[model samples]
Target: MVATQQTAGLSTSGRAVQAVALLLGFYLLAAAIVLGLLGLDLALYLGSDHLRPALFKIWALTAVVIYPVLRVVFLTRRPKGGESGGLLVGRAEQPALWARVDRLAERTGVRGPAEIRLTAEVNAAVREDTRLLGLIPGKRHLEIGVPLLIGLTEAELDAVLAHEFGHYSNQDVRLAGITVAGRTAIVHTIGTLHERADRQQAEDAAELRAEAEDRLARGKQPKDRSAGDGGVQRVLARLFTRYARLYFRVSESVGRRQEYAADRAAAEIAGRDATASALRKIPTLVAAQNFYLGAYATLGWDAGLLPAPGQVYGGFAKLLADPGRRAELAAMGLALPEREADPYDSHPPIAQRVAAIEALPADGRGTEGAGPALDVLHEPERTLAELEAVTLVPEAATKRRVDWPELVAESHLAHAREAAQPILRALTGSGLPGTVDALLDAVDRGEGRQLAERLPRSAAATAATGRAAREFLRPALRAGTARLVVLALAESGLARWELSWSAAPALVLPEGMAETFDAALDAVVADTPDTAPLRSLLVAAGLAPVAG
Candidate 1:
């Protein structure tokens, strides 16, 4: 790690600034230590004093007891876990990937990381796990975004990997890890303070409510204060807020410098052209991944019991292959916030990164002999299945993978079921006829806006009725028939609504809406003395009356 060694033996000015930052961190630590000691001394002195002094000593003892506890809590609180944004791939699972990473690390003059992880994010990085406020270095891991792997050729992927490895080469791995720990500590402390403030506020509100109830019982007025932070919590919260802002400002400034240096190291290894393209493609691919995920959520959710990564990727690739969508996504990527310099941002804007890469000496290299980067994985299908198993909806775990056309049909069927449930529930009671009459009268009175607002907003029913009201209700209301109105609602989107030969209504809730309706129905049936009466009433009405 020649670059890391060079950074270590930095010039006097660089060394001075680094030393100042380190000293400031040490100063905070020393001040906490001094406060603890002072409180300890005061506690010891007050223990031997009279009652008046002992009362004051109690406050000192409180400080002495709480400081160490808070300090330890701040030091030991787990960082919000890393993004489980993708699946993990061990050496045994992806030998070729690991081998390539080894070659890149050796070329980049950085030690091989402890592990490599794959994610669905559009970025790659080398991160060292830090614990105990950075007193201990846990394992270092390399995380590569799967979308980036899919988008980039082998040469481009190599350049991105080299860029991450560059951080390790310059010992930014360790420096960044420690600073990240400090940032986490600051955030955790602030959160804890706010949480305490929240609890106090809640208790105060409850007490005030109780007092108001008592006053009302006695025929008296109640007084309440505006909600806000109170007592010592307010001061501590404000202090931490200011400190967090300052800490991030200073840290991100240094962090940006590290990014630039790492960029330079990456260029030195993988060539400027490759690095520049890789950086530019990152945001674009990120936008594409978002679109891809939306597609999965909509059309691919219930495909089959075993959807593989390749199938998922294939679906996404088809999405990207659309000329119209590709252009829209490319525009979105360009629109992402980055052009303006944000003082707290760790990486500079993409334009600035590109400029920096351009300023470097050009190496006459091309992306020759490059292939698809994802080919390095051993069993992509199985890997994809495993990843989906953990991340997909529970029902999806048992679904069998289906082709794209089948997926689309399933999605439509699911949506139809969701849309119809609330309508059927509303129809169940005797009051449904009266409700329908009022709705028709409202439509005749041109009170569509008011009627729309008053419609049941249960997820499936709301969407269904909304569509029907907008597109079909006017015609049905003009016909002045309950059956026609119901028919129009079904046609427009309320879902298939009809009567069975048994002369009772048969309704299917939209695929996902049944659970929601079931929960609501549970509450109604729970306290009823005889659900049988309700069931008979529903049967007599030809549709069960249930509150939406």
Candidate 2:
């Protein structure tokens, strides 16, 4: 009833605009077809010279151009075929997920998507792909972002799925697909123009470069200039962009209204608070996943060990372990600009959506079996690992799971070997321990700054037993070489790597090692109050602080 009321309440003016937008989309394609037919008719008429010879020739040329463009634009392609982004989660492969979708659709009073798929994005959406100009039902697909699945609670996920279904309920999916096609057509035409212009520009630039080289050989000054789109191309691009913008101005309002209606429908079916909570968490969840990826890289973990789909929640949990950090991230997500929405923005601000959702009465309509949403898929870990191997991790890296300690240890040893080279060159059989000691003493005496500079940060730090030898290192290396230095440091007991539930890796110091090192470093740099030397020393020692 809420959905029906919302649809019925759409202003007459808005309905008229929607009609206009749909008509506009259809007319563009219809005009192309009509033009093609007119061109064909003109071509046949021209053979008889029924009109003046000059006029016939002009019509013939116009027809020749129009027919081909029309064929390319409409006749050669079906709107239904193309790679829509995401991994298709078929009913056979993920029956539970399909079942859940069907149940939610029934409750929401709408047909579910024709297909379901998984994505690596941070949000879920419903989309339609077809060529019937919004008149014929197209293949509607539901894309559920894996991160969202992992981060949101089961109820929240259901609300999100329901919200997407609401769009289908209102027939917005078909309308959006038509608008997308309209936009694509305009973009395609403009792109062709730009491509031609760019080709001409590139040729012009090559000629200019050659001319300048010849002028230089002849000892003459070459004129300075730039190559750009030809005037015709520039005009055409501008016209298309402007025309599309105008059409979107009318159409975008329709889109935004549809979104609001969908939201209302979703709130009615899925419970208002569930939908609101889902909206609230989306930004933070996305940021948390981003943090997980960054931390994985910073920790020097093998990319092949991309967090399993199930582990995404673990990563997000680890990231927000600190209350302050959690609040900070939440604040960042909520901090939208205090300005009106961009005319082109397809979605409204999160704050606005949440506020609206909050206004709806609670329905208390959660499904009984809404346990951990991950259970809907079979062998999620294997599925995620496979996705990672294909999309992110190199095939070679996929075979092994290298944790943080191994990564750090590997980085340390590699750097130690490189750092030893120059010291060995200078000391000539002084032995590794003695040579390293001498370098540290020189650093203490401010005499071996350059020598310290030559060595890795892990190798440069003076090694000492007990608590006095506290140090940190950040490998200034990439890929495989990066982890060797950390490994060496761990092996030598100069620093210990702490592998934990946290996404960020850290160095585990013996009781008070951090304090001892901090105090010693503070004393060493106290006079000048400059820590660059200490920082460099730590890097040389293989104990640079890992970035979180």
Candidate 3:
């Protein structure tokens, strides 16, 4: 009877694991096949019959090697065997919080005790060790991060903890960790390969340019160069770019799906309502985590630990503020309470997950449908308003003004100094600042058009100065309704001009607005004859004009 029961339990667990594994495996395989075909096409175009074959072989080998390595890495990384030394735990001043965790564990019948830890960001996870490697034979331990502990209410916290314990009850944590780790490792490897390819291409281009210069100096015509070189370069660049994009997409999809499986496991082990509440709280947590990560990066703590804060904030804020981004976020089901399994995404989109939870039957037992609605964790109105208040402005409109001739001279000097050190060593074996400066000046004049066209984007630090200027001029502009008064700033090299009211308040001009503004500015500038005269008159009258 004992042997029969053990066999039946094993069969049940295998079936559950197989069902999820097959679905996710099929999705990943299809993506890999598509990427392989594209990579093959690229290789063939570059005239690398041997290289193409080798690339495919390596790709296949990585897929095999990466999968197992990722599994092992993830499984081993978690806080297991009561390893709480590295984590910040037991630092909470609230005695009630510890009492709550103990009570919940008892109510859920968890064999392992849950340890609470704190982090600056808002996130919580139930970490455990199941001794899959057999060193401790079924010994289990649970750990909870502080961010989630402090962020959620008592009931919400309980629900989250229960959902984590659900992983233990369902025995899904072991497999979940492996899958998450494997996917991360594979994506990281692909990114590294793409970067290496880019570096190689850059080196090749530099070498080609040097060779071409030598040939030209020796009186060889451009037509004397070998055919197909341009085509080969273009093909190589295109192939690498395509491969990089596709690889990232595949990795993102895998990550999305993995999240869904974890969520499903949580719902099965705890309750549907608890899972739904946890999902709802994620966006706020993500925002807070991003803020802290940005703070660290700005202080130059570690570049590898976070994305550039400005870029991350700008991108996310744009997504949140724009109507289109709002719609997209909504479509992802950010406000919903159901879950839908997506084969393409590793995690089901938030909307789908919410739906899945809502669909569960109210019988208080696992069934084919979602459960009853839990209390919604609505964000404070003030918080939502604050997010809405953040804005993005055009870069060109807010750049600082500089004298074009002086700026060009400085750039020339810098470039000449850079080139002089190498040339001096190769020739006279001594660096001359005067000679370097002269050379740089000549190069700058020659490359003036190119530099002008690639003008720097507006600096965020300069926006405040620009805004002060706009505020000073606002009353004057509003005085006359005959024509819309727009302020124009000259480009660094005087190649072109851009207009703005203030960076934040983008002045939307009607059709033919530029022509009208140009005519007006031309008349004013023509009368004044110099930008300094006009700027002085405006500033003397309390208007602050910012120029680049």
Q: In order, what lDDT does every prediction score?
A: 0.61, 0.60, 0.42
TM-score of 2: 0.70
**What's the TM-score of every candidate structure?**
0.69, 0.70, 0.42
Tell me the deviation in Å of residue 288 in model 3: 6.9
Per-residue lDDT tens digits for candidate 1, residues 346-367, read 8888788878897887788656
- Cα lDDT for residue 14, model 3? 61
Q: Report the C-alpha lDDT of model 3 over 162-249, residue by residue, as the tens digit.
A: 6666555444455444444434444443444445456656776777677888878999854343323333224333443454355445
Over 420-527, each residue of candidate 2 has an lDDT whose tens digit, in order, gives: 454444333333233333434444555333333344445435453333323221112111122332343555677665554443346664444454455434544333
Query: What are the per-model C-alpha RMSD values against the true structure?
Result: 11.3, 9.1, 16.6
Judge candidate 3 at residue 88 and give its lDDT. 34
Candidate 2: stretches off by over 4 Å: 1-81, 229-231, 297-338, 362-371, 386-399, 403-435, 441-488, 491-493, 500-503, 510-512, 518-548
| TM-score ranking, best first | 2, 1, 3
